[model samples]
Structures are given as C-alpha cells and as structure tokens.
Target: MPGASAPPVERHGRPRNGLRVARVVARDFDGHSETSLDPDLRVFVSDLARPYGLELREDLLRRGVGHSYGEMAEELLAQALPAGEPVDLLILAFSSPDVRPGRSAAVHLSRFCPGAPLAFAVCDQGPAAAFTALRIASDYSRSGACRRAVVLAVEQTSLHHRPAAPVVLPDRHRAVALVCEQTDGDEALVRQSSGAVADSAPAQVRSEWAALGPQAALISGPELALGPQAALSGPEPEREAGLGRDPLGPVVEAGPGQPFTGVWTQLAERLPAWRAERRPVLVADLDRRLGRLSTLALPAGVAP
Candidate 1:
C-alpha cells in the first residue's frame, strides 16, 4: 500500500522557486608565465562580487597539488557562507580529486549544506565547467530545491602541462563561481541520451538541458580527432597506442578521442540541426591534450 500513491510534495520546509542568477566571478592565469600566485585574483573576485551586493569574504588560495576539487569547493563554501545557513543547492566542478571512487565535490558539500540538493560534473576546460555549473543550477531551480544555488568550477591545468610535450600544455588555471536564482519567462534545456557505450572507455558527455528561450549543446568526448566515417560506423578503435604502458591512462583517456568519435559525431550532427530551428548553440572542444578539468556549456547571451 505504501507504493500505491504519489507522496505529497513537502510544503512546510521546501525551497522556493523562481531563483535568478545573482552573480558570477571568474579568475584565470591570463598573463602569468608560471604558477606563482597571481595578484589579479582579488580584482577578479571583487568584480564578481559587485553585481550581487556581496563581497569577497576570504582569500583562500588554491595552489599546486595540496587540494582536490572537493576540498576547494569546501574551502570556498566555508568562506562564502556562515555556519548553519540553509542552502538550497550546491554545484562543484574541478579537474582532479584525491580519489576516483569517492567524489570529493558531493562529499565535501554534504558537510556544509547537509540536506541541500546537489549535483556535479567534471570537465577538462574551465569555461566548460562554468557552463556545467550554470546548467546544474538551472536544473535545481526547476526541481524546486532552493531559491538560490551556488556553483563553482576550479582547475589546476598547469599540472597537465609538460615541457617535453609543449603542444599539450594547457595555457591556464582558474576557478569561477556563480549564484543562480529562478526568473520568469526563463526557458529550460533538457538532456537526452541513450547512455554510455558498454565497451567504450569513459568519455565526457556535455548535454545542454535548457537555456534562455532555446536549447544549447556542448560536446567534449575523446573522439574529436577521428574522421566522420571511422567515428560513425567503425568498431570501437583500439585504446591509444601507449595506454597499456602509460601509468596515467586513467587521466589521459578522459576526453574525446577516436573511440568516442562515433557518438560525438552523432550528437554534433543532430545538435546543429536543433540550433537551426531557433535554438542557440554554445559548443566547444575540451581537447584531449588538456587532460581532465571541469567543463560546462551555458545558454548563449545569458549574463554569466
């Protein structure tokens, strides 16, 4: 009998709706030559705080390898929020973490916003990560979990750069934040997929659920390098030439590549057609050489 009827929606303590994006702040290694602390971070944070009527509460520096994505999220959340404040939603994005099986973002988030709804995804590019955070915030708003949600995407791309492979060097490292709220006449995006391929190694899937007035698509997979025919009809290609011998296979194989081309191409082809039908498209490549970083794709022209 317990399964017979729909549970009543909780109203007494539930989060409110119509959350609008309050603010967005981003910091990148735009002019830095090395990993030394960049002083412009304060300026960037200050700029982001202005539109939202908030100020930078703390200057927690995310450097080198001392912290993972989850730790970074925890530190930022602790500084931005006071203890016991009720949060409706939290979204964390990062390139790497201390462990694989245990997602640091979700875990650390639970500590500060105990009962708040949460969602997270990883990407190899900071912009992509920001896009993902925005979408997640929108989803939580639609679900009626919180009136406002906090979204963050941070990266240490310098870790993936190597002098020997100069072509593979990622030019920057950064973190970005956004506070989202619901608004009227705001359209939503929906994500549709058949799920992952059984034999295909893990690959990044950036699907845009909804955006302002139209839908968008951002695809980051390991298959960008493959030709159309090979990507579409070919069998799963063999793993990269040296994957078996490389110790970093786990991280190296995270983005789009030959094996993922089939799916990527399929989506790419279909997404454009969707856009032509009045949907705005925001697509980018989180190239394989960039290694793993959080990625996102937001509604075009939506002020970040």
Candidate 2:
C-alpha cells in the first residue's frame, strides 16, 4: 500500500468529452454497538438552527462501529487502486470538520497513494461538494492536465464529533471511490445547477430526464426528497415506479451528518445493475441547505 511520491504536476489540453468511468468501489461501516443521544449531548446542541434529535439519528449510530472518515477513505483507495499504481489526482469530498487541526481527510488519504497527485479537499457545500469535486476532476481530466484521477467521498456519524451546523445522518459510516481515466465519447456526465430554485428543480430535472430518454432512472440525493409527483409528471405512472422506490435504499436518509457521499457509494453499488437493465442512470442531489442541485447521468457500461 506504499509507493514513490506523486509525480510533479503537469498541464494539458482540454478534451471535449468528460472522463471515462473505470473501477468503482464502496464500503459501509455498520456494526453492533449502538450510541444513543444522551441528554447532556442534546443540551450541547439545543441552540443550533438545524434538525437534531431526529428519528434516524439513533438509527445511524450502531454498536461497535469504529472508523474515522480518513481511515475509511484509505480503505477505499486500497480497493480502488492497484498496487504501486499512483493516482494522478485525488479529490476527497466530505462535510465533517477535519479530525486533525490543520490536515484534511484528503491529506490523510494521500498517504495510501504513492504518487504526489495534486490532492485537495472539497467542502463548505455539504453533500453537493461531491458534485463540485467531480466537476473539478472531470475538468482536470478533460483538460489533459492529468490522468488516472481518483475521487473519494466519505461521511461518518457525528456521534463523536459534534458540529454547530445541521447535518444529514445515515445508517452508518460510508465511503466511495471512483477511479477515472481520460477518454472521449458519449459517457457519464455530471451537471450542477446553482441558485435556490427548489420549486423549479423538479421540473428542470424532469426535462433532463426527457432529454436522456425513457430508459433513465432517477435517484434523488438524501437532501432531495422529491416525491414522484414532484420529480416526474407524465402519462407513464408504471414507468415512474422507479422514482417511488427508495433511490439509494431504505437505510440511507437525509438528516444528521453528511449523506451525500453515501449517494455516490450507493451509485457505485447499483450502477452495474442499471447497466445490465440497459438504462442510463441519473442522480439528482439537491443541497436543501444551499438550494443547489448536482446531477449525474452515466451511460450504460461505464462501470460494468
């Protein structure tokens, strides 16, 4: 799991298309030990302006679940990268505050990759930061600035580290790693829309689905709790059943800590299934806190 330092950074031309998706791996840390929201902890968070003490908060923390976000990211990198193969770029996205005073999870993760790939951290946008990271990675890869970029998105319960701001909670700790390379063709694309237009988000997303065709499935992020009526409005109720089902799964919900990384983690797991069904998958993540929407549409066979 150790190698030479990352290569010196280089600049390159901008290719027209986005990155060609490669290996994808995800991990979920759920265990038997459980942590409850005690009264003293509740008192510490009594003045914040976000949803706390929600039903899912207790559900997110389980017994014996122990792993920091950086450790999870390292595990993911080990799974995504081959031995001694250095990554050209590393984009680590997470919402929690850094475990160390001056270091970030990205910095901790860089230890796993021997190369001096231009590693950086993306934050301050919540789960939507993953979309921002992808955009930067795609632009870097397309511009020929680098090759073989790895994106690691991680989220863990704030049971141990409490922040003042609101966060989305999930069933457990999770991380996702996407190994991307430079390629040109019709492939997976990520689209992010800014401004607080929550009302119009559904309609715009519906239009994107129309453009992608009927085979596209809609997976809304935890921040985006769009119902079928709000997300899809057409004559095909039966076809829209996919939207009615839990996009990521029942265990994942938007509430306490950052759940955006779990969105990618879930995508990594189910992408092959979507490809097998011969359908293009569209993921819509709305930053409910920031009124931003990040969407990704990947063509079949990108991962499979």
Best by TM-score: 2
Candidate 1 lDDT tens digits, 1-304: 0111122234577633434434444443333232123344445545655776654434232442222445445555655454545566777655432212234456467666535655556454422344455555665565665666776655543331112323222234444455555654333232212222222212322122122223322422121112111122323354332122222211112232222122223333443333334334322223233232222232332322
Model 2 Cα lDDT, one tens digit per residue, 1-304? 0111122234454334456566568877664222222333333333332466323233323332334566667766777775757778899887653323334557667777858688888888866777677777877765566667888877665544344564445556778887877666535566776676566665666555545553333433222233212343335763245443433322222233335665566567665655566555566667666777776666544324
Error of 1 at 147 (Å): 2.4
Candidate 1 Cα outliers beyond 4 Å, as residue runs: 1-19, 27-66, 82-85, 96-103, 114-116, 124-127, 158-173, 185-304
User: On a 0 to 100 scale, what is the lDDT of residue 253 in model 2?
Assistant: 25
Model 1: lowest-lDDT 10 consecutive positions: 221-230
Please state the error at residue 252 of candidate 2 in Å: 12
lDDT of 2: 0.57
Residue 276 displacement (Å), model 2: 3.7
lDDT of 1 at 97: 24
TM-score of each: 0.39, 0.68
